[model samples]
Target: MTDCGCDKAKAELVEYLHNELARDDASDIREHMAGCADCSSEFHVNVVMTETVQRACRETAPEELRVQVLARLRDLQASHG
Candidate 1:
């Protein structure tokens, strides 16, 4: 096993994808991915899925719908709080 275990690397994957991980943590995930085919495949799939959704959202989001959604979220949050 590498210094960074696959479980730890995968656990931090969301942070890595969001560009929120520290440099050292990101490096550990990279090192693990370099050596683990299964983990790498999963990570790649997550990357592709995230990118596709983001691109689609950027290109096709309805502005009015977005406003409505934000308003609804704010209302919901206010109610909960």
Candidate 2:
């Protein structure tokens, strides 16, 4: 496997992190990261950021906030419709 240089690897890091790249492209990024410390470090940061965003998305709003938002939406619907 050829080392896809840092430019391509960095450019595709997000797609690689989210499994959005085609198989061969992903493999190329992985191979590049294996040998390039800079790309690897950037990939690690992206991984942590992706995990953090995923975790944040999983969190539910407070019950009071949910109710308030729903109430506001209902009021707007009633006013508009």
Candidate 3:
């Protein structure tokens, strides 16, 4: 819904939740977020969603699944080529 100020001049707040700006840029974004309620809420939700997904992956993704997927991918590639 909201563009977070990238190419489209805005993007989802997830873009900023990483806190990945340079020092001056981070400061400017923080200042803007402090005044923007919508952006602030989006940032919080993005953080929570990220953490939730990370935890879910940690609990559910087994090493065996990775191996199986890789093997299938190799087989598929071999057949296609």
lDDT of 1 at 33: 91
Tens digit of per-residue lDDT, candidate 2, span 1-81 = 788899999999999988999999999999999999999999999999989999999999999999999999999999999
CA lDDT, every prediction? 0.87, 0.94, 0.65
TM-score of each: 0.66, 0.75, 0.55
Q: Name the top lDDT candidate.
A: 2
Instruction: Tell me the tens digit of each residue's lDDT in model 1 across 4-69.
Output: 887898888888889899888888888889889988988998899999988988885689999999
**Candidate 3 local Cα displacement, residue 39, angstroms:** 0.6
TM-score of 1: 0.66
Best by TM-score, which number?
2
By TM-score, the candidates rank as 2, 1, 3
For every candidate in turn, the CA RMSD to the true structure comes to 6.0, 2.4, 6.2
* Superposition TM-score, candidate 3 onto the true structure: 0.55
lDDT of each residue in 1-70, candidate 3, tens digit only: 2323432213634545676655565655666667677667766777799999889888865799999999
As for TM-score, the candidate ahead, 1 or 2, is 2
- Between prediction 1 and prediction 3, the one with superior lDDT is 1
Error of 1 at 39 (Å): 1.0
Q: Candidate 3: worst 10 consecutive residues by lDDT?
A: 1-10
Over the full model, what C-alpha lDDT does candidate 3 score relative to the true structure? 0.65
